[model samples]
Target: MSTGKGPVGIITGALSGIGAATALEFARLGASLILADIETQSGDEMITKAAELGGTATVAECDVTDYAAVERLVARTTADLGRLDFLVANAGIAEQSRIASGDPARWARVVQTNLLGTMHCVRAALPVMRRQGEGHVLIVGSTSGREPYVGEPSYLASKYGVVGFAYALRMECAEYGVRATVVEPGTVDTPLTRRPPAVRALLEQMHPLAPEDVARALVFTYQQPPHVVISELVIRPLDEAVNADMPDAEPR
Candidate 1:
């Protein structure tokens, strides 16, 4: 269950959704885990689940938007677990807003958590990856990030920024033997994606994907030979099509 170092993977937002799934996925693959989340109880629950798989899963408190906090997270993980190998920047926000009637404050929250948070994790994890000379980052993003989705302007923008982060960082980190990949998943069965009856019906009618589906993608990325970087993947539901007629986002 141990990598050459103690832990094999480090995942943020490890309390739920794709984050928890990825931790379990890696644990199933015999990888020790460092799972970070602000939610102590849920994070502990995740750690316990991984422990049942006979793998070590350490939980850390990380607010990815706070650079100092993120830095300390990586530093502490490395110190406790030894050499770090995999990092998943999977924390994000899901706020529904139309540009015309959007709350600027909500938009800011989305950008801060989804976009800047990814940046913070990447910045913090990159140094650990560099030292190892071999590391992989599987970023959790949304299909809206790849193309576009109506009614969620800020969410789209932030995920789009995540795509840019992975692509650009791939270029910068290639020489260091580090790989970056963005996994764009369609709607998953998570509290974040849960909705009212009408909204849930709409999403089911459109695109819907499971957390395990994205977790499979993460494991695939992990299994790849060090020579390749699986740059970007867009996973959408075959049953759904996105609407593009919605008005563009207006300035807040």
Candidate 2:
């Protein structure tokens, strides 16, 4: 857990699921964190947990969908921590609907949060990282980005955009010593994944990966040497059936 000289990082959507788990994992390694989320109560809880781990943490109430809010979050992190070592663009949302039946409003929300939100974070954080001459950006993509599913066309499109952006960003940031990685996790059993009972039941039967499992993959990427970038990682539960036809779960 003691990653000597731990990094200073920001994790979006740190109130629950993969974001929360990743924050705790980073705390366990003694990293200083800025947990950004709209959920104040849960954000406070995460701060307390980080303290318990002997790590420093602060909560930033940020709605990633808001560019100004996301900008302020990054600004605050640098102002407080003096340097931004990493950014985890893990804040996302999902809804289940077919392309033909999906609500336009819902689709817009999904695109904003899952795609544009990540873009904002990357845009805001890269300059700070460039100034520091080193940093890492971890984009939390999903398996849906890689393959098609039964429902949720909008969600799939957003993730696909994220995956594409992550790679392009990686190349763009390499010269500045900033690393970018996209983590595509399949069937993670988190609050985000448990919204629909039908999809949840199907996932449970397959023993979905835990939030902690995905967190581990993230931490592994962060711990690597600056010269090495694990550009993209696809993690799925053992025995998970890829392309299984199940009801679409929530977007995030």
Full-model lDDT for every candidate = 0.80, 0.89
* Residue-wise C-alpha lDDT for candidate 1, range 42-113, written one tens digit per residue: 766776888786667878887887899999988887786677788999988777767779899999989999
Model 1: runs farther than 4 Å from truth? 1-7, 204-207, 242-252
Q: Write the per-residue lDDT of candidate 2 for residues 106-188, one digit (tens) a residue.
A: 99999999999999999999999999999999999999998987777888999999999998999899998999999999988
lDDT of 2 at 248: 54
Model 2's lDDT to the true fold? 0.89
Name the top TM-score candidate. 2
> How much is the lDDT of residue 141 in candidate 2?
99
TM-score of 2: 0.95
If candidate 1 were superposed on the true structure by all CA atoms, what would the RMSD be? 3.1
Candidate number with greatest lDDT: 2
